[model samples]
Target: MSTSLVVGGSGRTGRRVVERLLAAGRPVAVLSRRPRPAAGVRTIVGDLDDPATWPAALADVDGVVVCVGPPHDAAGAETVVHRGVAALAAAAAERDLRVVLVSQIYVTRPQAHPAMAHVTEARARGEQALRASGADPAVVRPGWLTDEPATGVRLEQGDTGWPTALAALTPDAVAGSL
Candidate 1:
């Protein structure tokens, strides 16, 4: 069976991704700064800022799903989002592993809200880095995430915004898409 690593597996969305993968019967590992023990899942403690910790979690893994997000501090967003995701993409590329990056919709838009500009910029950079890594990765850009129940989902390409009626997407819906 194929084994995959879920980066940021302790976060809200990441947790859902882990559960979805496990339910699908895929062997999974979680990369986190703290230990997260789940039956049939392996947890590898590591920091995204420290490159040395990557290989151990990635070893023998067939793919990776990056669910990490930028820190609240704008200054740290670059390191955590851009640099961190870039590093992960590079390492995954080296191993010929498939990569799925969970990104935000319209992150590169010039009209993004001022309060979220920094994070959007960092996410945009992360997307660029992943594309440049020669990994042919799949990017999932979810609309504002919510805890609402999963009604259904749709996939579209290009710069399309979520309908005004659909205010947010549930983490469960996004995880299932991955």
Candidate 2:
């Protein structure tokens, strides 16, 4: 991909993705409701919740990487995660661009944990939207994020296990997986 719009590039996970993309000598841009990237990276400050806010054909943009979600504001759960991502996915699909969406482990089992209820329900919808939108998204499912040093890496598919990794898997490692 020539240029990929990174959602939540200012946040921990997306920041790591942006840094790695830049280090690889790739052109990087971010789509955010607000905030900007470091110098040299293009920043598109817009809220995805607004359908009209989606930018079109800027700099031959070819892909997207979404790393935005909870530890988020529960109030904006539906708008930000589901509706917004769905719209963005549709836009990307229309352009034939691939999308890499960073989702969480609890999405499949929505009511399993009360603490993540909001995120669970919303992310489920977001995943469904990406699928239905035909963005050909690669969804990364992680668990409760901790800033502790990444001790190991593991991948399991059943969506039933420890909520997180063996040791607190750092954002850096998670980004590496991407």
Candidate 3:
């Protein structure tokens, strides 16, 4: 059976992915700080800053989906996305697992805001780390994401707003990709 470890699996997209995986009869393990009810799914509780607590979840999995994000506080962005993801990539390498990242399209944008500069750069660095970790890495850089209902599904490759791009993927869509 194909097993998947979904980081931040309780968040907007993560939750959906977990549901889809379970529905598909895949062994799904979720890494999240919040304790949610995912009856048949395994929930590993831990923060990105301390992933060591749940090493078992990272072991022997076919694929890992990283949807972790940093806090809005200053300095948390790099610590969470860049540093944390780097560590996760190293661990995944040790386990010989493939990794998939859910990233923002801001890394490819023309302008960078002063407030979000580190966030943008860190996300790029995280991508680089994943690629160099000797694991098959797939990156999904979405535009803006909305929690609202999806009017329809369209997959286009362009400078779609990050939130909009994020909106393009429903939990079901991402789970199918996994």
What lDDT would each prediction earn against the true structure? 0.83, 0.77, 0.78
Question: For model 2, how does the per-residue alpha-carbon lDDT over 1-178 read when each residue is reduced to its tens digit?
Answer: 5887787887878888898898988888887766554877888777767667565423477778888855455768888888888998888888888888888886777787887788778888988899989777788887657766675567776576464454435787666765
Candidate 2 residue pairs that clash: none
Please give the RMSD of candidate 1 to the true structure: 4.8
Instruction: For residue 61, give model 2's deviation from the true position in Å.
Output: 1.8
Kindly report which residue pairs in candidate 1 clash with one another: none
TM-score between candidate 1 and the true structure:
0.87
Model 1 lDDT, full chain set: 0.83
Encode model 3's per-residue lDDT on 77-129: one tens digit a residue: 77888778888888888778888999887676526466777788778788888
Q: Write the per-residue lDDT of candidate 1 for residues 78-146, one digit (tens) a residue.
A: 888889889988988898888999998877673656788888888889989999997759889997677
lDDT ranking from best to worst? 1, 3, 2
What TM-score does candidate 2 reach?
0.82
Q: Is candidate 1 or candidate 3 better by lDDT?
A: 1
Models, CA RMSD each: 4.8, 5.0, 5.8
